[model samples]
Target: MRIDCPHCGLRSNEEFTIKGEVPKARPDAEAGQDAYVDYVYIDKNTRGRNVEHWHHSGGCRAWLVVERNTITHEIYSVIDVQEAQ
Candidate 1:
């Protein structure tokens, strides 16, 4: 697998680090038990094209937006998360 890093250019996927999903805002700490439950267990382990956060640990140390097909282990795109939006 390969990923294109904005700072370091194209490189092997091994050069990056998986940082899990780029989550939305978290519920308030004082919102109670449900908030804690959701925070700990809510995650979308999607099988098709999905957006995930990754870091180029072995390259430029920049965070990347990885568009991957989880089931086939095929990566469609890799771009800097900051520049993606």
Candidate 2:
């Protein structure tokens, strides 16, 4: 697998670290058990396209939002989260 890093360009997936899915929003602690469960386990495991959090461990050490195709394990885009917004 390969991912194109905004700073470091395209590189082997081994150079990056999977940091799990990006949460849509922060959960409120007061929301209790249901909220905690959703926050911890509810994620769209879509096969085609998805946004995931990844760290370029072997490059710039920046967090990136990667657009990937899970089925083929191909990365389409990678942008630094800091600059994305």
Candidate 3:
């Protein structure tokens, strides 16, 4: 599959690395161990229309927000992270 990077044009998926789901929250220094463990090691494993970050390692080296369908491997949208905000 190809990911269309705004800075580099359409590129193969290999050029990018999956950076996992977006970090919703960071455990505070005073947070309990279970909270920290969940933050560090858990994966939501959601299906369909998942939001994620991808790094374009082979081209402009920019980050992008990818809206993809996990079950079908179909990407719905690709936006530069900065522009996305």
Worst 10 residues of 1 by lDDT: 20-29
Which candidate, 1 or 3, would have the higher TM-score against the true structure? 3
lDDT of 3 by residue, 1-85 (tens): 8998988888899999999776668988999999988998997978987989999987888989998988887988899999987
| Clashes by residue pair, model 3 | none
| Candidates 1 and 2, the one with greater lDDT | 2
Clashing pairs in 2: none
lDDT of 3 at 7: 82
Give residue 74's lDDT in candidate 1 (0 to 100). Answer: 82
lDDT of 3: 0.88
* Candidate 1 residue lDDT tens string, 1-85: 7777778877888888998877756888788998778777887877788889999899788888888888786888777888877
Alpha-carbon local distance difference test for all models: 0.82, 0.84, 0.88
Worst 10 residues of 3 by lDDT: 20-29
Indicate the residue-level lDDT of 69 in model 1.
Answer: 86
Residue 61, model 3: Cα distance from true site in angstroms: 0.7
